[model samples]
Target: MPSSRHLIGELESANLLGRGGAAFPVGRKWRAVAERASGRAVVLANGAEGEPLSLKDRTLMATRPHLVIDGALLAAEAVGAPDIIIYVGAKHRAAEAAIRGALAERSNQLRSRVRMMSAPDGYVAGEESAAVHFINAGDARPTTTPPRPFERGVDGRPTLVQNVESLAMAAQIARGIDANTGLVTVSGAVRKPGLQEIDLGWTFSDVAAAAGGLARPVQAVLLGGYFGAWAPVDEVWALPIAAPSLRARGFTLGCGVVHALSEDACGVDATARIMAYLASQSARQCGPCLFGLHAIGECVRRLAARSPQASDLDRLSRWSGQLAGRGACKHPDGAAGLLGSALSVFADDFAAHQQRRCLRRSTSHPASLQPVAAVA
Candidate 1:
């Protein structure tokens, strides 16, 4: 195995970014834990894929469990940590079984330091603080920051929480392989909706082509997950899917979710339903997330149902500004961002819905909005 300094140096050189949506630098994260450790640090392999549109992590674990295990082991060795935790999603039974079965094949020394736990079902359960909190307290909800996972985690020790794909990439990098490829979860309107392995050079268009093309003429795409916003088809059709590059361009490749909206679908209606889902998944640790998100979700829900009050749209814009930076985690901010995006990408639809109309090209009754699926 490479030394801690050597491996971390390589990670930095390769610019390995987290695949868990944050796009945080992998080396910096491991270094923070390594520096804070007295051989007491912990490595957490995050397979708690709570994003409804994302299945890359669980699929990776089920099909390539050994790679994930190797990455976890590498993370532990590189960070001078004796303990490794495979924090997989509770709903991902096949992944859990695969990970456990793979661990059984490892040497006693390697297996002894590793343990597996089922993360609770919900989106917030995938947050870094939430993962640590769950391991230490049996509750899978995000906690307030300051003593972040790096500063303190799991039994009050520094921890490195990494996405499973990022770790798989790490393992590949360790073997002198280039980690230039990524996995994207393509859902909604694609003929074959599932995982698409993409090169760093691939664009959103390529992703679409790989998924067997769109089933219909898409109006827009819900890039990232529910926390992300809708991008008009023209705006993102040719956009690069590279996480870091996308972030630089004011876009987020969150959790590798790329959901296409069919031409016949209502963007406003989809956004509204997604908002409701996100609000329901709140950690409920703070008022902004608990109450404010509910309020925003309710407003969108009413708008989707074509019964918005005179002030619903105005309140959405206002509440987005009001709720940002006031939550325990970034949950409220994410919700606000999504709402903001919806208001922009679906402006026409919002206005039409206000007048009991739908802009869908295939609408049977143009004056009445139809029930649309929410990125299903």
Candidate 2:
């Protein structure tokens, strides 16, 4: 294998970011693992599409299994990992089958060092630390971090847990292919809800138009998945899908999900449902997560139900602010980010809910993944 420096430098030049929501720099991550690995590290090709509305990862794995395998092999070699694990979600049968079959066509030496693991289905199961914890303990829940996966992971060896999409892009860059696109999963009230490979700097309108345009009047867009914030549709329709661009505008391209919220749906109601879902997915490892999330969910639930007491609004605002940086993992932070964004994005509706004068809207589809047809 070539020196890790070469691949890492290429990735840096390409300015690659992880596709699994965090958008961390790919080169920086690889450089860290390369530094930590002592020929005993493990590489995790995370195909665990545990996020409810996101299907870009599995879409890539099922459609281009070889691409994923190539990236994983490259990562193992570059990071000095002797073994690689393809962690596909237990429910992602097609993706698992694709990779399994792809591996069968590879060389014997490559096949022997790689293994497949069933990732438990949950929002947190795909998290890097949780993925490691699952491999070690058979329980796919997040553990507190200090010794991150790169420092110490499976079998007490440093591990590199890169998202499958990130791996694929790395492979593309390695092969001198243009790696300037990001896969975004578009759903909710779109005429054609599916996964599309978007140019990183394309405007949101372009992505939406590619999804067959809007099926209804969209009031706002959930720019990121549950972990990301929401912004008024008009306010962000011109913002580029690129992470740095979105971040400059006080938003993130979280998990590459662009779910359009219909004017027929209530953002407060939608947010409440998401809050409850995130709360239910908690690992129950710490107080802030176990209790605080439940409390926050209940408050939002009351607001959504149009039965909030006066103090409930104040509590929701304050509690969400206090929830960040307090959990065992980022689980609480995700919930906080969603709730905080809702408080701002749907402030008018929230106030309406408190005044018992809320308007009617269509039902929400929080888990509406639908079939992810890749944009050709």
Candidate 3:
């Protein structure tokens, strides 16, 4: 068994970052829990991928359950945590079965310490705070931060909520291997839409090729998920997909989602639909998240339908600024990020939509806009 200090050193050398959207350093998070946890801590493997465009977590859970479990156990040992919980979305039947079968293979002591739980099928259900709150109380809504999960979570004990993909990488790091590749889910207008293990430094075109190339001529790409930013196809095709590289360009490889839009798709219409879906997923706890998202969604819809007033765009810009950082959670901020990027990245498309002259009849069916209850 590796000491907590040794494990942190190994992770730091491997440069293993969290595969979650935040891209936080995994080693630092582990060290924080190790030092701050006063008593028995909780290790939670978060496989409840609330991002609709992302399937990598479910794929990892179902296909590589052992790796995820190994990582969780390693984390448990590192933090001196006795309890481990694998949280999956309620509808993820295959992943649940895989995890349960894997858990059955462990020793009685290990099995006794590990368990599984079903997460609510909502976008915010996968948020770290929301997951901690759900495990502590019955509600899955996010709470205000200050005493973060690592500080106080799960019955007032420090908790470590890690993404499943991050755990899989940690499993590799435990075996003296450095973190190199990551799981990516490439979908939408692709010839072969599926999950692929990609090298960290690979370019966007490399990712596209792993999915057998684009099924149609590409117009733009949503680099992350619904809460992520968009980039023109030409601008990002050759760009490296690594977090640092993308972050330098003011973007992230958020949840390893790469959704491509076909040349014939209407960006304005797609953005409007996605914004509306995000609005519906709000917890309704904060005024900015509930009311502000609704207002922005409506405005985007009107713009998509070419029925917006002259000042609609200006109002959207202003409201996005107002809604950001004002909510208890980052729900409002994520919506604002999506809307702001759409306005900037697809300026021509939005302008055309406002003039009732869409470039192409939209053939895009963004998975991000699908009803959460309908996904499995």
Candidate 4:
């Protein structure tokens, strides 16, 4: 596609927001890079949505690679970048192929302008800073940031690093029209497990309906990815998917993967499994992360072993806040986010466990939602 300012205008008009789980404004991020004096800039499309329960990124790269690449190119043009990078998990071969195919079919100029880098598949590895570190010869782990990617990135140059869905939304915005919302991959206990693009401000019920409704009566909803919130189905019923609303509710419209569990699923056991996965995914660079995650995991294991004691619950609560902002990365914070929400929404469950009488006992669902390995 020819370079054009109209593309930027289109994004601004469409309100084509970023869908990178964070839901940051693409227009604002573009302006940040556009104002930089570094002269050299780059765009990185982060397709490593490491949420094991979510397939939105892989689906997008598999079926709509051109749109994402087009968005990346548009971002590059807006920021005056001559180069663009598509960072994907190594294991997503289908997505890699789709991106390759999309690039091959494009003009030689477009093809030559973009580079695809497959990152090691790990949860923390997909964070923008981590991806940047990996691209710059460091390990695929997040580095402490005062110089965030927008300020200094990709060999100390200004960069726009966004999720694959964010870039794809930008591409759609480049088409000069507003999309109602964006795509989401809703799995777990849903009648249909797939990706669907819906209008903004839709409720959880709307998303669930699009997915062909629940396979069984819903017990609770895990909105976002691994480190997201858990709410009773009732609380999530009219819940809007927009970041603002979700945040207001003490939740986030994260990676757009809502895992609705049935009444048969034990919340405590589920929490244990997820915590175990988070602990394992740590890059093991920071003390708080390495030890805190293990400690938290051990705590969950205790809870699962029998229900946590009232004292145990109190201890978990205290540690949740302690670890919230102490880590080098957001791993602890995200873990805290998920755990805190679990504590709040599943208060009864925690209490029941404390009494050694959980409402549900089934552990049929896997212990973890982490992909077997990082996708790279």
Candidate 5:
């Protein structure tokens, strides 16, 4: 086995980035913990797939629990941390059970060092700071930064909170393998929506095809989860999935979600529903997040229902700008990103809705805006 330094060096060489949506360099994160003077540290494997459209994390935990555990243990050893905590969403009972079963198969010493905890079921509850706060205070809300988790986390020690997939990749790197593939949850309007292990260079259309292709032709794809942006089908279907490539095109492969919106599904209506959910998921810690998001959600809902006044669109646009960079976490910014992208990518749809001429029939009862139920 390679030493921790060698492991981190290999991660850097392979350019492994966090799969937890942030895409931070994995090697740099580990080195920060290893270099800290405080030898007291902890490792957290985040499997709280709180993003409603994402199922990749829980799917990995269920199908390959050992790999996730291996990655967590490897990270614990690399950072000189004696304890590892696998944080799963309370709703993900199967993932929890799989992890516990995986833990039981490890050596007594390894089992003693690693434990599992159930996180609250909410979007922000999976944030790194929120996970640390929950471990320390039993509250899963995001706190102010500067004393970031890496600097002061669980029990006032440095903490490494990594996504389960990122840790899985780390485990592979430890075995002298370069990280090139990612797991994407291809949901929404697909004939066979499920988890897919795809190469970074695969085009969006290729991933859709691997998922048995679309059940209906799509107008746009919601890349990433709710926190991610939208892209017109014409623009994204042939685009590469690599982070740098997506970044250059003003997109992120966040939480590895690729949701398609069929032509019959009004992009405006779907975005409105997601925006409302995002608003409700806020920690309500800041004014911009609390008030700004709610206001934006209401405006989009009106626009989607074709009941918006002429000024509603302008108001939504202005609020999107006002809410950016104002939240304690990135919740507000992400909500803004989703709404802004919808307005831009589906401008024609929005215009049609404004004139009470949506292409799809609006359901008499709006679809319930709730997080996707946890799957086994």
Candidate 6:
């Protein structure tokens, strides 16, 4: 039998929001699927977060798959969907096993209802619409919106897709956890770089402390992921991690990613590296995302290679805005957000570069921006 609708009713009253990068209200998404015509609907836990620097989704699935699956089950019941799909990244073997094991341990009623599928290893493949396409024998690139997942999804049925962390949060809400916190995997220069559950009202300082603080004096902090906010370390310490508050600061919660940059770290170089990675991850379906992200990455590369001209900076900012909302998915918007934040956070470096000076470390290669795991 389906879990009690009364339990789902309790979840609805908690005002839970998706902990995914998009942060949609979970109850609203439930309503969308629930009210669809009497045909079948589906629920997906997107554990395919392929961004190498961000590990929150994988961590959730690996360590707490039951929470994710229970949440998925609740979502499926709420929407009257007979099937549940837990989509995991190809490389997330640990996560895949956790989901399988958790399902195996469940009653036959639950075990028979859910299917775990692996997706191609690409960053954009985890996007909701893209996941629907991949599941339907189409390529893993995102399609044009308005025929969005909620309206027409997997096999032409309504689908409610959410990130693993978001589903886990829903489970917490279903269980009536008050002031439910979400997980952020803090990495990079922090002394501890692991998944930490923090209340929404907590400041960046609290997260940093949870991650064992910085390894050295910090120059800046990157919130979210590759497509995230770049703030002076001091300034970010004042900002809370909640979606609404962070959005008011023009930031996306971005799948619970928090990266700290050390004093010796070059924000300009780090930004360039991440941009290059994002460019490489493009599924190449839309012309704008395919061309625009590579172009942005190329510009960042040139700036890091030699002193960039003031014109170079202006050109980057201009292109950044042009690419903001022009793609089939949020890829362009993510790229623009990262670029804009880099421009704002690396102002001093941009100035120095424009004046014909380099600001990179003498002994280290630029790739040190790769994150490290947090110790307990």
Q: Write the per-residue lDDT of candidate 2 for residues 1-376, one digit (tens) a residue.
A: 3355698899988889998888899889988988878778899989888877788888788889999998988888888888999999888778888888988878575832988898987999999889999999988877787889899998889989999999999999988886789899898878888788899879999999999999888888887788888889998898788888898888888889998888878888888878888999989988889999999989989988888878888899899899998976888888898888889988888888888666645545542323355321
lDDT score, candidate 1, position 266: 85
**C-alpha TM-score for every candidate:** 0.94, 0.95, 0.95, 0.92, 0.95, 0.92
lDDT of 1 by residue, 298-359 (tens): 98888877888888888887887787899878888888888888888889888887776777
**lDDT score of residue 287 within candidate 1:** 84
Alpha-carbon shift of residue 196 in model 3 (angstroms): 1.2
Q: Model 3 segments beyond 4 Å from truth?
A: 109-112, 361-376
Q: Give the number of the best model, judged by lDDT.
A: 5
- For each of the candidates, give the backbone clash count: 0, 0, 0, 7, 0, 2
Q: In candidate 3, how many Å is residue 133 off?
A: 1.1
Better of 2 and 4 by lDDT: 2
Model 3 lDDT per residue over 239-300, tens place: 99999899988888889888888887888888988899899999999988899999999998
What are the Cα lDDT values of the candidates?
0.84, 0.85, 0.85, 0.79, 0.86, 0.78
- lDDT, candidate 1, at 312: 85
Per residue, candidate 4 scores C-alpha lDDT tens digits across 65-150 of: 88888778878878788879899888789999989888878857683278888888789888888999999985888888779988
lDDT-based ranking: 5, 2, 3, 1, 4, 6
Instruction: Choose 4 or 6, whichever is better by lDDT.
Output: 4
Q: Which parts of model 2 are misplaced by more than 4 Å?
A: 1-4, 107-112, 363-376
